[model samples]
Structure formats: structure tokens, C-alpha cells
Target chain A: MAKSTIKLRTKEKGGKIQVKALITHPMETGLRKDKKTGKKIPEHYITKVVVEANGKPVLTADWSGSISKNPFLSFSYAGSKDDTVKLTWTDNTGKSDSIEKKVGEK
Target chain B: MKRRSFLKGSIAAGAAGAGLAAGILTPNMAFADDVADNPFKAKSVDEVLKMLGASGAESSDKIKIKAPEIAENGAVVPVGITSEIPGTTEIISITAKNPTPLAARYTFGEGAVPAIKSRFKMGKTTDVIAVVKAGDKYYTAKKEVKVTKGGCGG
Candidate 1:
């Protein structure tokens, strides 16, 4: 399983805090025909992604062959006390990976 | 000069001017035009959902996606996504109709962006739909970007 990790940090806000994350993957579409091989690359892409915070699920996405390689995502969340956000991804090839991060109040 | 011959000459000139105008407008129109007409041979979002077999979903307005209004090059158009929604979970996609609509899919581990940035090559102009799964439902937004003639070749 190819795993990933996210590290979240936020400035102290009286109400809510924002969080961000990044993932590592090839995200190959397998569409372009290789010049030398002269064959269409087999479809090997991330089909699903999941993100969780403090034991609660927050965001998820479905992907297609159009995504670029090594995708980078950023987002914000209402922060509370010590919270943890977890991430996981699965590809069409059935390969999956996961990682975790701790949220800190600034 | 013969009256009939003079009238005919003016008509020919008028036609040429109209033709040139059309030629110039064509390029501009192509830039703003969405590729829905030639949508990439892609699958429907519903079909992808069934294939992925996802369970949890969420919809939130906190998500925002930014890309160029008109991409000169369809080969590599940059896209960025940001979510203000709390407790981010998943991100999914589906182009109206492409060979394979599921674009780049990602999830957050710890310090992941409620957002993601990537470059996608558009065979033609089309709407890039970004669906963010938060909580237990799906929330989505889409923007149509025009893929004009690129440097590679039109």
C-alpha cells in the first residue's frame, strides 16, 4: 500500500481554525501513447480520496483520467482543541494508502 | 462604365469584407466556447460513483476552484481548489463527457489543502467539475474553460 501523510497547523482563532494537506501519487492517466512503445498507457489512476478530522470524516473526492501527476490540495477547517485529520486514497488499480496529521491551535 | 458592371463590382467587394470579419471573430469565439459540443469521451459522474463504491458524502459551499477563464493551451491548463468547509474528507470529479471523466482525485492526511492544484490537458473546451465530499454528502461546483489554439499545434 502506498501511504501518504498530512501536517495541519492554524493560527489561534477565537472561533474556528483552517487546515491544509498534500498527497503523493503518480495520478497517471495512461492515455498518452508512448513514442517508443507505440502503445496506449494502461489506465492507472486514483479513483477515490478520503479526508478525516478529529475522528470525523470531512472531505472526499472522485477522480478521472484528467488529473495531473502528484496532485496538491489545500483547504480550511474550523479548528477546535487537539484534533487529528487523516487522509486516504485508492486507485482504479485497487492500490490504496493512508496517512495522519495532528492539528494545533496557534 | 456599364451600370450593371459597376453594381456587380460593389457587391463582390462587400462580400470580401464580410468574409474577413468572420475570420477574425472565429478565433475569439473559440476561446470562450466550452468544449461541451466535443466533450471528451468520458463517463458520467454517477457511473464513477458506482465504480468507486464510496459510502460517506457531504456538500459544503466552502469549496472554491480557480482556473483561467480562457486557456490558450488546452494541453496544460492549471487548476486550483480550496475548501473552507471544516473536517475535509474527499474530492472527486467528472467532466460532462470525456474519455474518462474522473480527473485527479485526492484526500487529506494531516496538513493537506482543503484544496488541490494541478494542470489538465483538455482535448477541447469543457466544464471541469470538482465535487468535494464532506461530512456525509456531496457538494460540487463547475467552471467552463475554453481551450484555444496552443503552441504545439492547433
Candidate 2:
């Protein structure tokens, strides 16, 4: 599967750079009815997420069915000289995706 | 369909008479009692996400998000985010693409740690998003969560 997209932005002097990422997937909460068959939908959800800067992991997340589709994530990292960050995620279906971003220090 | 009609019909019944109002009110009150703490409302993840303005493009890595490998209960899965980055402005939003994407939204000021933890209901299996804002930038982290039968009332 394709990895999620990570966006890094420049932070102010002594400011933290903001990083945002999004992955495309159906966060299927097996609760609603199928539009066609009118049957309850099967369950599908993501379970874990991790983030690293210049290869050093910094943030992680745990999730459930309550989350929305095509999960979106936002967080911050100490403005670093490394200029690169990595991200990874795994789902309940034994699926995983990861990506990396370059930070702009302007 | 039935549930929607039931909700509307009860509202109509409540408007009919004081007696009917009392009668209809009892069930709603009972429902509130039944789900006094069932934070789950039947909305798709997309709708919830939009409602909260939690688009990840405006998020940043200054915040840290933590979640579990597997959730035993869909109704009460725990999620956490902490900002170790400087100039942290605000931390907000949780989305699960199951039944209503936007779970919750939080706001903070500069220098605020912007760390938060909360329980959310998952309609099924899906990925979750933690969107945070630092300074003038936005960041996000995502995790996939698996829900077993024991979690939701399955």
C-alpha cells in the first residue's frame, strides 16, 4: 500500500516546526448498514502510528473504529537541524504504511 | 430508518400534549440513562473530521501522538497526544473513519504542552488521526487500530 504523505513547515525562531500527515484508507467501523444490501458493515480499523525525526522516533498513536476515514494526523517536533522526519502506521488488518519528510528551516 | 423516525415521532409526540410529552420524554430520558456514557453517535468519520476542521495539511510534528496496538472495547478506546516541540500553539481533533470521523477537538495557547487523552467510540476497524498546530504550522500523526468483538457490542 502507498505510504501516507508527511508535510513539514518552517517554524519561527525558537518555534516548533509543524508536521502533518494523511493516509488514504477506509476506517471501517462495522456498525452501519450496507447501502445496497442493507446489512451491517464489517469492521476495519487502524491500530498504531509512529513518527521519527532524522531516524529518531518521536511520536506514536493508538487508534480504534471511532476514528474517521482516510485518517489525518497532526503534531509538532522541536525545530531540528536534521531536516528529515519519518512516519509509519499499521492497521488491524495487518496492513502498514510509512513515509518521510524534509523540514524547511526558513 | 426506524430510529430516525422514532426520534422525530417522539419529538412530535412531545409537542402533542403534556401527557404525551411526558410519555415521550420518559423514553428519551431512559435512553439518556441507558447511554449516559456511550460517547458513540452514528456519524461517519468523514463528517466528523470536516466538522472539526481537522485537515492534516495544517498540522505539525511538534506534537506527539500515542495509541495502542489493539483496542478491547470500541466504545472506549484511549488516544493520547503530547507536544514536545517548542512554540506549541494548539492541539485539537481525533478522527476515526468508521462511524463519524471527528471524535473531539481541543484548543490551546502558545507554550502550552497541548497534551490530551480521551476515550472515543469506533464503529468498526479504522485508522485514527491526531492533528496538532504549532506556531503557524500544522502537523499530524496517524495510527491504525484493530477492534475485536469484545470492544463494540458485537
Candidate 3:
């Protein structure tokens, strides 16, 4: 809903690019109860993470409550310095966040 | 409600692990395709495999799970998995005795490496299994991680 709280980084070297992203979310599993309220916390977590470079699909990851709060994802893809990488995530409640960056970004 | 506010409010700049934020691309803010169903509902590792229609997965040395021996935060232990087996294409991480054993899954594409690294929440000290699908068969390797719940250990 709000502007993305995701941090992104992309680097290119020797005909390859590495992309890393960290998503900030509660990732509540609904099993953990409030210490005081004694009620189950509702399940909320990023369900799917998709990455696109130069407007083409590159990677997609599916996750569940098992993922830790504020999940970190890092992987590599073939690309050059000028290629752009965009990442988006959808959660169980349908809320979403996205961010994009070009390779070689600091 | 109060806890939610504290959690959400704490997400200021650099809160997402301090990764560099580059130029924001216009109109690239679209949500992803239909979200897949959560994999945490499956009760056991066997059930998780059944969901994928995979069976007879043999233990293999080629598959390696890199996790810490002592995890201070049971909720976020960085775990890495790599499969040196040729033709390794699909990978999944599972816990042997959690409420739901399967933690995550990935399908590699052309030229992609047979490796994955992500953080997983351990309900307790358990064997975290990394399974790789090469060709038509499945192979697995596991590591035991002792999770100190509630950060009680000093």
C-alpha cells in the first residue's frame, strides 16, 4: 500500500549480475500469541517474490510463514551493467510492495 | 494493534537490511501475479513431498545445508543450500519436526546455479533438510541447528 519498504542492490561483473533484496514485514505466523493478550497473531508474510531485469522475468520465489521477519534474498542472473532489475512481493493479505534499480547502482 | 504500529513504524530508511536503494523506475511498481498458497500448512516432511508428488528421495552428500550450530534467534536463522549434483533443477528446504516441515522451494532456470540462501524460522532445535531434484529423482541432505528459544541463553 505505502511506498515500498524493500531495499535493493544490483551489481554487474564479468557478464553476470547479482541482485539482493531485503523485505521488511512482520511475517507473523498466526501461531505466535501476544504475551499479554493471549491471542494468536494473524498470519502475515510475503508470499511471492518476483524479480525482473530489463522488463523480462528473471527469478521468482515462493515463501510462507516459515520465512523470518524481514526476509533477505540474494541471487545471481546474467546481465550487464546497464540492465535494470525490478522486484515485487505479494503477501497473504494481498498487500504488495515493489522497488527497482539498475545494475551497477551503489 | 500497538505492537503492529511499533513494527511498522520501525521500518524507516535502511531498515531493510541496509541494501543500497537506486533510482526508482517509473511504473515498475505493479504487484506480482497471483500469490501461491502458503507452504507452511503441511504437517510433515513426508506430507510436503507428497504435495510435490516426489518420493524415494535418497540422502546424498552433494546436497549441503549451511546453517549455524547455535541460532540465537530461532525466528531468523540464515541458511544456505547448494547442490553440486549435475542437472539439479528444483530445490526445497524442510524441517523435520516443525508444525510444517517445508520452508521454501525454488525452480532453477537455464544457466542458473543449483543453490539458494534464505533465512528460516526454526520452531525448535531440529534437522533442516535441503532437498534437490535432479532429473527425475530427488536427493536430500540435512543439518541440525540448535535454536535457543526466547533468547534465554546468555
Candidate 4:
């Protein structure tokens, strides 16, 4: 299998779970022109991101191409150690990737 | 062959009826789709807010936006938003001068916090606005970030 495009980490501190994710994508806005080709780059960016904790959706984000390339996201939730956290993102082109991590795990 | 065609027609009609019933039973199902429809196409912050079902937002001090007053590079400006208001269900960030002003929208569930940190691209100097939805009211905060360089490619 190809390497995953998402890197996720979850840590439990003071009975709260901090989730951080880094996703690798170009996040093209379709307005940029290629320097060499002088052609516009087609728009391609993540449209939706869903973060679930133990099978329950804790956060749902809708994003546009204004987000920087190689997006980094950090948020927290009220969760305990050993709980599972899953993050999934779908781009405008229908491409998607997901990753899961267990809280308090290295 | 006639009998088979008749059965197929009946099945298709029944499926369509069931779908219509489900759509009517869950109005939120349609509302969710409406909310997700082309929000990025909005050219201004007001249009984006309208698309999000918010009429207008009042300025508030409880919403804190953390961003540099002057950014050397427009390619990546780190921003953090924290809403002190209780029962915040949604948070939206917009770059006022971008070609498309709407940047990101986040909906928090029961166990989630109403805060996030992320990076956004700035074409030039612009006002970064944060909108927070608590209960049935919407509040907003704004911060100006001067960009020395443009991030969008020519």
C-alpha cells in the first residue's frame, strides 16, 4: 500500500484529548498559474474533514482552498486515555484519506 | 417479458417513493446538503454568512484570534481561534480580502472544544474574521494581519 497522506497524534492530558493532524496536499486554489507553463492550476483541496472519537463524530470541518498547503490542524476534546480517535478528509476531487490513533499511545 | 417489465417498473416507482418519504421525514438531511453546497463560491464575508444561515454577527470580545500583526511570508500565516462563549456550536474563519473570503467552518459536537489552530494563505494584507455561533446567536471578532508578500501565485 502507498504511504498514508495523513499524520495524526492524540495525547490525553488532564482528562482532555488533544488531537493534531498534518495532511499532505497541494491545496491548489485554481487561480494560480504555473510559472513555466503559464497555465492555471486546477482547484484541488480538501472539502470536508470529520474527526471522530470512539465512533462518535466530535468535529466536522468544511474547508476551502484558502487553507495553506500541507495543512496542519489542532484541536482538543473531552476524552479519556485509551479512547480511539479517527480523522478522515475528502477533497473536492473525491480523493480521501483517513488515519486512526489511540489516545496516550506513542 | 411483459410481466418482467411490469415488475421492474413497479420496483422503480416504489424506490422513488421511499426516497421522497425519507427526504420529507428528515428535513435536516436536505438542510445539511444545502449548508455544504458551494460555500466557497461566496465572494464576500456577508455572502458566506448568509450561506451558513447566519443573518449578521455582532462584534464580541470573548472570541480571541491569535495571529501575527505583521507576517513576513504570506504563504503561511498561522492562526488560532478560541471562543470563550458558552455553548459554542460553530466557528468560521474568513479572510476578508481573498478572492473567496470564506476560509473554514467547523462544527463542534458534545465532547469537542470550540477552538482550533490552523494555517491559511493570504494574498495580501487583509482582515481575518472569526465568527462564533453559540446557542442561537452569532458573534464575531476581527484582526488585521499585514502581509509583506502575496501568497497566491501569479
Write out fnat for all predictions, comma-separated: 0.45, 0.12, 0.45, 0.86
For candidate 4, lDDT tens digit of each residue in B1-154?
9998899799989987886776676679566455334568789887888877775788999999999999998879999999999999999999999999899999998889899999999999999999999999999999999999988886
Docking class of 2: incorrect
**What are the runs in model 3 whose C-alpha is more than 4 Å off?**
A1-3, B1-39, B150-154
Candidate 3 structure quality by residue, lDDT tens digits, B124-152: 88899888899999898889999888321
By descending TM-score, how would the candidates be arranged?
4, 3, 1, 2
Query: Candidate 2 on A1-106: residue-level lDDT in tens?
Result: 5333333343323556566656666766766557788667777777667666766655555565655566666656565545576668788788877766667532
Which of the two, 1 or 4, has more DockQ? 4
User: How many steric overlaps are in each model, in order?
Assistant: 55, 77, 0, 0
- Compare the candidates by lDDT and give the number of the best one: 4
Q: Rank the candidates by DockQ, best first.
A: 4, 3, 1, 2
**Candidate 3 local lDDT, A18-102, one digit each (tens):** 7778888988876787788876678888878888887776767778778888999877866778888888999999999888887
Tens digit per residue, CA lDDT, model 1, A2-106: 233333344325544454445555655666666677666676767666767777765565565575555555555555647666667788899887766666632
Work out the iRMS of candidate 4: 0.8
> What lDDT tens digits, residue by residue, belong to model 1 across residues B8-76?
799879986886666666776564232222222236655555544542334445777788989887666
Per-residue alpha-carbon lDDT of candidate 2 for residues B1-154, written as tens digits (9 for 90 to 100): 9998899799767765665555556777655543332233426544434434444444455556677768777666667777666654555445565544545544543222357555566656677776665666666767787777333334
Quote the positional error of residue A26 for candidate 1 in Å: 1.9
Q: Relative to the unseen true structure, what is the C-alpha lDDT of residue B51 in candidate 2, on a scale of 0 to 100? A: 39
